[model samples]
Target: MTGGRLRPGTIFGIGLNYADTIREMGRETPTTPYLFPKLTSSVIGDGEAIVIDTEITSRVDWESELAVVIGETARDVPAAEALGIVRGYTVAQDVSARDLQEADGQWVRGKGLDTFCPLGPEVVPAADVPDPQQLAVRTWLNGERVQEGTTKDMVFTVAELIAYLSSFFTLRPGDVILTGTPSGCGDFRTPRMALKPGDVLVSEVEGIGRLTNPVVAKT
Candidate 1:
């Protein structure tokens, strides 16, 4: 199934879950998970355009992330049982408005903008992805690779994140966890290469499918 097939539910996002990414940004590893939320309104199916709102912010960036789809109701689950509730996985692009994100001092508006989360061409069932931590996540902009990393580099594994999240709330069906992105994001690049009009970005996660989105100016 594609993202368009999902039912309305909560979407939790993990931040600073990659040690190398944290180091790349000159931050320390979190003692606890840094969590964020991405609204369901932000999600769009594959092959959609990621509109860059230049009027609101000029520094639009792209992040390739692995999205976990919950299959069962889980409350205070342990890591050993966390993966049992997973329905599948999907590739997602976490588009961001860097300037607005920084100015607002929170990720709600910047990370939850409409069309900011491009998810799924299809969902690969959890059974198909035996080891989520071994998957590779890559981002390409304008036919050139910009970011490449393996889930093994993640500071927190998928099961660990699920267990951690379930400790605080019930994770029901259709809830998605956008596991944090890796390093090589534009935010840390020299000369600051950011998304502009007329750019196509492809977010790929191994074992799942890819999402190709063109960047366009806001209407």
Candidate 2:
């Protein structure tokens, strides 16, 4: 289903899960998932505009990720059985306001802004995607490829993340897990390429679909 019609229950996000990402950010790998929460209100569909309130923060960045869709209610599951609770996969953009993210010393406000999370074209069933770790994830800014990496580079695999999350709370159907994004976010770029008005951001996942959103200033 398209993001416009897909309303998830809870939106969970992972950070520093990719090796390249860790290096780019000059941080160490976490022993466990670095978790955060994104508000469901930020959900937007393909073709929607990712409005940036320039007054709030100018360093709007793009994060391409593989989104996991929960299929059933699970708690304290084992990694081996984690995949069974997945309904499917989709493309998601974990848009961030870098300024707020750093200044607050926490991520909720920076990453949970309205329209910060964009998902879909469509969801590929779990049966269709045989291996989540083998997919390629990418992001494009204004027709330029800014980020490129594979899910295989993820420090925490899909199954591991699911099991880890389920241990603390129940994962219900329609809940989404934004498996960590790979390196190459604008925040780590040499010159830093931030999203601006009139720019377009495209997030894609192999076997899933591409989600395109335009950048605009909040008027």
What's the lDDT for residue 154 in model 1? 87
TM-score of 1: 0.96
lDDT score for candidate 2 against the true structure: 0.93
- CA deviation > 4 Å runs, candidate 2: none
* Total clashing pairs for each candidate: 0, 0
lDDT of 1 by residue, 1-219 (tens): 543544438889888888779998898899888898998898887777888777788888888999999999889999998999999998878888888889999899999998898888777899999899998999999999999999998888899999999999999998999999989899789889899989999999988978888888888
State how far residue 11 of model 2 sits from its true place (Å): 0.5
lDDT of 2 by residue, 1-219 (tens): 643646899999999999999999999889999999999999998889999999999899999999999999989999999999999999999999999999999999999999999988777899999999999999998899988999999999999999999999999999999998988899788888799999999999988999999999999
Query: Candidate 2, after superposition: displacement of residue 112 in Å?
Result: 0.5
Tell me the lDDT of model 1 at 65. Answer: 96
